[model samples]
Target: MTNAVFHWPVSSLVQITDCHLLATPDALYQGIKPYHHLRLVLDELRAEAPLLILTGDLTEDHSADSYTLLQQLLADWPAPVFLLPGNHDERGALDQLSQQPPFRPERRLALPGWQLWLLDSKGDTPAGSFPVPRLAELECWLNEAGHQQIFWFCHHHLLPVGSFIDRFDQQDKAGLLAMLKREPRLRGLAHGHCHHAYQYDLPEFVQVGCPASSVQFLQTPDWQTQDQGPRACRWVFTPDGRLQWEFLQF
Candidate 1:
């Protein structure tokens, strides 16, 4: 329910997704030390980007210690950070850190020319879909915006890109897509969870599926591993609502 206002808010933003950090640095997920990978990429992304959007799935174990560790890790980064929740994340765990700076619980975030709708898409199972209440609120927002540009960020993907992640991807993608199709002001949408880096164009907007900052999926069913470089995404927005983006993998 809070609105973030800046005297001269910059339009450029950097998105780091699916960190999946653990309680300990030595702990591993899917044969990869997620903490090690996240740290490596975070060190390199300490550039002049004005905003940082951490899409979701911040912890693999849902440990409070892991969230604390993440907070300490980004304490001094130059840009303001926005944290969105992923399916693996627990809302109570994230809410405990809500009072801290750059650790926000806001569903809607405003930028100079864009309104980032950080939706709550987590369902009862790992595969996420918004609840009826949250869905209603989202629909209202989409209907109310007059001419403001928007960039929707969430934890799951709307389209299945031939990846095995379809099992845990968005369950209500059709409803979500229908909303987007109705809105011409939507500039783009960003997400994590598949651990793959790819972009697709929707007739009037763009969709960016960010790779995990920790690891990636080789293919399907067995959940095999392939060497996926830890990655981050960047978007530079102009006052007039034009956005250009790039993905950085390391």
Candidate 2:
């Protein structure tokens, strides 16, 4: 072995999520017309060339045309893109679009000094679920990994976002929480499917949710009406592992 030491810093990471691709004959749509907004956001971030992680819910439905459109949209991303599963997505279609190798749903990447665990918690059925075997498998793998820090990426929210969506949460959330409690090296957790950006403080890790690149949920309305918010949200990790986030409103 050589004396070279691998250095992985925060600036190398960026995550975008919830680009629910709904196909139209001429273009794509998401209720509020967000394609142009998303393109602008990505265009700005392209210069930095950070490692991009797309959390989940890539398509509104498991349609071939939608997947193909998504592939075309992301074909020119400046940085490498990694994807996970979401409730509305089809594993087969997503894999083809991402050009991911056929192996397991989970993705384990070893960066210079950081470990990225992209978990596929979406079962065959709708919503999300984590059977005992999958939970145990993740635990075992975490035990074998070593890095300066670790970031957990998934499609479903581990905790309840709100009453409306809580019913769709992963069944084995308690099991996952137990694992998180013990894994002190877990620096952060990034996920999608909530369609909103909400950060939570767990026991030992920072849990940050990304907004949908297409449409977002209105938190509290001014006139008792819930309207769709514009697309936004991207994160920047510094070279020393510090994370900064910003939301772009188009």
Candidate 3:
């Protein structure tokens, strides 16, 4: 590990998630339209060329057509794209389209001196639950990197973003938190699924919720409410290990 911290870093990174791109015939959302504004966001981010970390939900119905559309959308990205699995995304489809291994291991990579750990929190069913072995593996990874700056990406949020979302939250919150407590090097935890941009300050780290690239969720209490707007985010990672995030309105 490099103990050297540069006063100025040249490279940066961005984390995106919850890009629910649904096609026709997806029973879950029938008439729901696609968020067209994502195009504008993609155009802007393409200029920065930062490490685009897609947390989950690449497609709405997990259909091949949706994946095709997603491919076209990100075809021109200038940076390395890392995708994780979401509840809506079919693992088989993602593995096939992304052609990368699943995010189920606890290993260290030379990511500009910042450790990136992608944990699989998507349960077998729609409800989110941390798989036993995966959870244990993540805990061990965190413990090993005692105070090295790290960024964790998962499909499910460890905390309840809201009541409607609470039901779909990660089941092993205590276990996740316990592991976080042991790692003082944890910089932040970012995820997707709530369809809204939110940040929660935990005792161990900051919880960042990225907005959906396709649509925005209504902030009202009524679940029946809906909003049609394109959204995205650009996360700038400084060399000294400071992160700055900005939401892009499409």
Candidate 4:
């Protein structure tokens, strides 16, 4: 994976995930018009104007036309945009956006004092998995990074959030957790797919779930809707390696 280094005046990023947009503009998912909701969220995010990280499930139909729609939606965005895949996304279809501006496929981003590692946790099933090759690559990247503060962005939650969605959590959690425990420089991890905004203050790092830009799911034993409109997550990186974040509701 290529690494892109940016020396920005401000160390901030916006994460908008799980858009689940369809090819048709007015199509609805779970009674929510995803395209309309995502447009509203993007409009609200225009003021922040940070490096945008879209954490996956970009298309519900996994169609090229759906990706084309996403491309059009973000065509005029001013800042850099990074994208990852979710269970509902097709890698080939998503990669086509990389040929254009604002849609970057680079997995590693180098900030001033921090390194952002965007991992692809989309596996065969709804649950996530880190195959041997991916784990080895990550291990090498972590070692080469050499004490730089690290932050991870992926589509699957690394840990359970006490809900039915837990069944779809990353399948190789222990392997990832082991790596996190050994890497003291790792500061935080942000993910989507839960469609709910929550945090876990681990001894090694802070893990946060990004709210969906399309719709949200209630965090309960059984699946339910969280009709709080569309949302996003904004993360600020301090010079001292501390991280602060908040949810953006539209």
Q: Which structure among the candidates has the greatest TM-score?
A: 4
lDDT of 3 by residue, 26-92 (tens): 3334244563544556676766766666778777766788877666777667555666788888767
Q: How many pairs collide in each candidate, listed in order?
A: 0, 6, 1, 0
Q: Which stretches of candidate 4 lie over 4 Å from their true place?
A: 1-9
Which residue runs does candidate 1 get wrong by more than 4 Å? 1-8
lDDT string, candidate 2, 72-164, tens digits: 666776556677878888877766655532212337655645667787889766567888887787777776775456677888877776645
Worst 10 residues of 3 by lDDT: 1-10
TM-score of each: 0.90, 0.80, 0.81, 0.95
Better of 1 and 3 by lDDT: 1
lDDT of 1 by residue, 22-138 (tens): 999879888788888888887777666456778889998989889978888877766667777798898777666655776565666666777778776777788978666776777
lDDT leader: 4
Q: Which stretches of candidate 3 lie over 4 Å from their true place?
A: 1-10, 24-35, 100-109, 143-147, 224-228
Q: What TM-score number comes out for model 1?
A: 0.90
- Model 2: what TM-score? 0.80
Q: Report the error of model 1 at residue 192, Å.
A: 0.3
